[model samples]
Target: MNLKKTLAVTATAIGLGMSIITPAHASTGEENQESPDACMKSQSASVFKYAIYFNSNYGGAYRNVGYPVYDFADERVGGSPQAGTQPLLFCHGGSGNNQGIKNNAASVRNKHSTYYAVTYYNSGYKGSSDWATPNSSRNLSQAYNQNASFNWSSL
Candidate 1:
């Protein structure tokens, strides 16, 4: 083909490609950008629940529980515990129902909002204590591992 015809064809192709691509890119960008109200609404639709992993760093067996879990005695609390194995616990800030987790947790992840999940070494929310900040995760100290009796209010 002549140079003029080839150049014209190339320009037309480029223009057509952009026309096809622009709308798709624009729509996807809009979908990905969520408004504050929309984000809050979607978040509220689901209850605030946190997961407790048996292994460290949020791995191994996991249980997603709502606030106010007093005990871990109920087999249903985090599903049946593994046979012949004491799984370490990991959790963020939330209410601990009572004495069930008195001496069971190994680690914790604090993902609560602007509050710390205070873990008590002894039951009844007493004894030595450790606190985790919101949106943080860590392995508990040896003294606190398998020694969490209660989860008190945020710090």
Candidate 2:
């Protein structure tokens, strides 16, 4: 092929390859680059959902879980997408300190700019639920201490 054609073909191939390799969040057009947080690469978000608290009114034993979890029992915390996660833990002072987050959260703050933070009462996002709008917070009514799963929703 001619020089111009060769360059064009190579560029096209690289672009196509990038689509597969780029993290999902980076490809969403929200930002041009992947987050620096290691665990963010696989599912890809610049930040964690929000503060899920062990007390009502958004107090005590809070964690910034960086991704939606099927169950808090899944001992994993924010880290490299390639590196395995350690158990999720409270970062500071609180009544529930030293305890795991599974079925323990009572209130939450939603920090995502694009999605509502939804917490469920059963595993796999089933059963009763409560939600906090982006940048908002509220104590769970139905789920309460029974919380089991979590996910984000655009609606």
Candidate 3:
């Protein structure tokens, strides 16, 4: 084939490949914003959901087991507590500090029935306990444990 034809064919193939990879709704003229149908979709629409359990102390009198599950299937509408969704937990990225996931109490609570942010500090770091203290970590951990006990389907 001539150079012009070869280049045209390659460009056409690349365009076709990208279109195939893009979602159907997105491939259409839809803007980046999510539609109300997408927004209302619940956690039940998620492909992954599960919980995590841990013990404060293993095999000892002081040991206390806790469950911390992350269920993606709780499809409560975001920012609507009246939707009867499970309490949402927001954990800040990379160290999970207050600044990482900082939000006003009311703002966080508005996401669901209950909302919590988890903060954790690096172990053995010599610094004031005021920032990301162990107590806060434990408290958030316990909250996750309690929330994990629910059957989100009923909510």
Top candidate by TM-score: 2
Compared with the true structure, what per-residue lDDT tens digits does model 1 show for residues 58-107?
44433333343333332222334445423223333333322234354556
TM-score of each: 0.44, 0.63, 0.16
C-alpha lDDT score of every prediction, in listed order: 0.41, 0.61, 0.22
**Which residue pairs show backbone clashes in model 1?**
69-97, 70-97, 70-98, 71-100, 91-109, 92-109, 102-148, 102-149
> TM-score of predicted model 3?
0.16
Against the true structure, whose lDDT is highest?
2
Ranking by TM-score, best first?
2, 1, 3
Q: Where does model 2 exceed 4 Å of error?
A: 1-46, 75-87
In model 2, the Cα lDDT at residue 16 comes to 36
**What ordering of candidates by lDDT runs from best to worst?**
2, 1, 3
> Taking the tens digit of each residue's C-alpha lDDT, what string does model 3 give over 14-79?
563421111211111111112222222232342212111122311101101111112222223332
For candidate 1, the lDDT comes to 0.41
